[model samples]
Target: MYRDLTIGEKGKDVAQLQKGLRSLGWPTGADPSGTFGSGTAAAVRRMYAAMGYAAPLTASAVTPSANAASDAAGVGEGGEQPGSDIEMGRSSATPQPTEPESTVMLPVSEAVFVPSLPARVVSVPVQVGDTVKGPVITLARGDMTLTGFLDPSEQRLIRTGMKAEILAEATGVHTTATVDSVGAVVTPGSGADKTASDSSAVTPQNGSAYVPVKIKSSGRWDKKYADQDVRITITAAATSGAVTAVPEAAVSAGADARTTVTVVLTLNA
Candidate 1:
């Protein structure tokens, strides 16, 4: 009275066979299409093997009784039943707690990062298992620049666009650079007015006045020089043509607050 589903067959009976295979965790290629194909034939052989049947199926024909056996194995075509953990090859008599399925999703903006320009990561402030409270990573780009601090008197002479000489003591490389910028504000106790090429270098101390200055090389700078101490000499001023000079001792301030230079004249007899 029950019909057998075989390859090349179509209609609702073939669809039932496909559903039965899927219920037993043997996928029949796709959703029940009501037409038996090569995929269905392969799944039929696998199903027969799982059921401990040594005899090969006839032309991949699935009998109605076999569909009933598959349904009883674990889950029905409709849904999963209580204590029906057939995928594990076992079943429990007592009903177990069913955990609800959970899914987590994040917004596109929070999930992706788009930087304004091309950059390279300099450092990561956190490690694995550390909670992120502030900045996670630092990025840098473009040419490298040198940062140095100067005393108030020296700062007054250094200005942006001035030519500077750079010397790396470690490598003995001398290079020409230009003053990129000069900080207008002076912080106090800023330790010794030293040059720093990285973040770990000497920092400003409390109550010391020091102005920060930035200098950039005129040409390509080697990355190996980064973070190393370097000497910077900025040409505060320059002049051309002949000029008058005098000794330090001869130059003096008069009582009237006027500068005067002592001149020595030799008489020829």
Candidate 2:
């Protein structure tokens, strides 16, 4: 039911055309003046181009043969190529059917403004301004596993099948997971140790190196939080089950070759 109108034409239809273009993110400049002017025509071409209905218009882009079609279509210069079915000067009451344009869809590179090709983002590769081949985004496909660092001492308390609580800070959602694997203790040097005279002078705050822990998330999570931080808490042992315990630093070998605690346990109640 669409009728084609061209430049210098005045009607409410022209105003409606301008309004539609504005809604589609194409600004028709300062006026929606009820006349098909150059501005409205240019916006129409952009709309057509975005929808892949026509080749994009550019000052130096359209060929001479294409220009002739553009002129006849009543679309501004550089507009979509007119179809072969359109009659140039027919004044019949019944509208003529037109063949769809036969032009190939413009390449996404010409239509899309992204610096990289459309792709699933896996991880950031090149930094800003770095040149890349196809696909700006990295692609990844798999079930998600949680990776985190745990104190070497804490790692010893965890084993496969241990339940973990993962809290998403953004949504305040708590998700349950199970320990997948606890890697061997890794004594990664603290940053300050790299520049310190004595590497031992800079030690981890916990007095122990860290170990890698992998957990499998058991609940669904929004992909928006992919590669983001989450709080992981694992309950490996119950304190209520312990009848006696001593801090690591408090126990030492005595003259009798027995471990002695700084303070003796006394049950008063």
Candidate 3:
């Protein structure tokens, strides 16, 4: 029984997704703007791999037809038989290979900085002499918003009131503060060439529909720096314990995707 089969960001937006999902049978009440929410993910997980959309979390992305069903449940470590490879040469001294290991699950996130918004500087909202808050962030708008989303599995890694160091864009000076809000409203849509880090490419669909975050606090800005932009850094949560973890820096594609590992080793010359 396939429930949620979302043809999301790669397709429509969240509301449209929800509508389409409902039309397709899994009525998540999700807005099809292509947002990746709890309702949509759960539905997809149950309905996906079985329908061949993707594979389940495992030791590798490259699945094995002969071993997949056997490995479906957790394989023991070192589950290989060296003798099986030899043709009629049964060696009593061969060692067995290890079984597949369990995978660790972590919440991944994409970020948006103040400069990344399609809103543009549009006259820096604050002036140098004006008072401002410490925590500052900007949301993207448009087709990208609906397509760009943070998996709900990653929600636990981010939180409100987390401490964030802030920096002004023009002056290159920075300050410190704590987070005040986490938007429950996710942006929908994606671009062929855009990424979480590309500021200039994040233009919104409706133009004025971006949800830039306004930090709430009290501090006087150096008047000369009022027109500058701000940026914030948030901490990512940890999901350690025999699970797979690929550092974001190691991935070449802006780490825009995730997958299981088949082999990990170092060649010692």
Worst 10 residues of 1 by lDDT: 103-112
Q: Model 2: which ten-residue window has the lowest total lDDT?
A: 110-119
Per-residue CA lDDT of model 1 for 1-269, tens digit only, reads 04545556677656766776686688888534888776776777677677785423342223345444554554434465644354443333223444442222111222113223333456779898998798777667655567776776786788789988888999898888888888755554443333322444454555566677888777767766766788888877668978877989999998999999899999999
lDDT of 3 by residue, 1-269 (tens): 11222223333334444554455576454434556455665554545544775523435233345444344322232454544443223332233355664332112221122222233222335566767765233433421211222344555655666666666677788766555554443343533223332444344445332333224333543444343445655566546568766776555533657653455589999
- Give a tens-digit lDDT track for model 2, residues 80-192: 35554334322222344554433222223432222232223566566779888656654544444466568766767889999988887976777788888887665646553
How many clashing residue pairs, candidate 3?
40
Error in Å for residue 227 of model 1: 1.0
TM-score of each: 0.36, 0.40, 0.27
Q: What is the C-alpha lDDT of each candidate?
A: 0.63, 0.60, 0.43
Cα displacement (angstroms), candidate 3, residue 36, comes to 66
Task: Give the runs in model 3 whose Cα sits over 4 Å from its true position.
Answer: 1-157, 186-212, 222-225, 236-245, 249-266
Which pairs of residues collide in model 1? 188-207, 188-208, 189-205, 189-207, 189-208
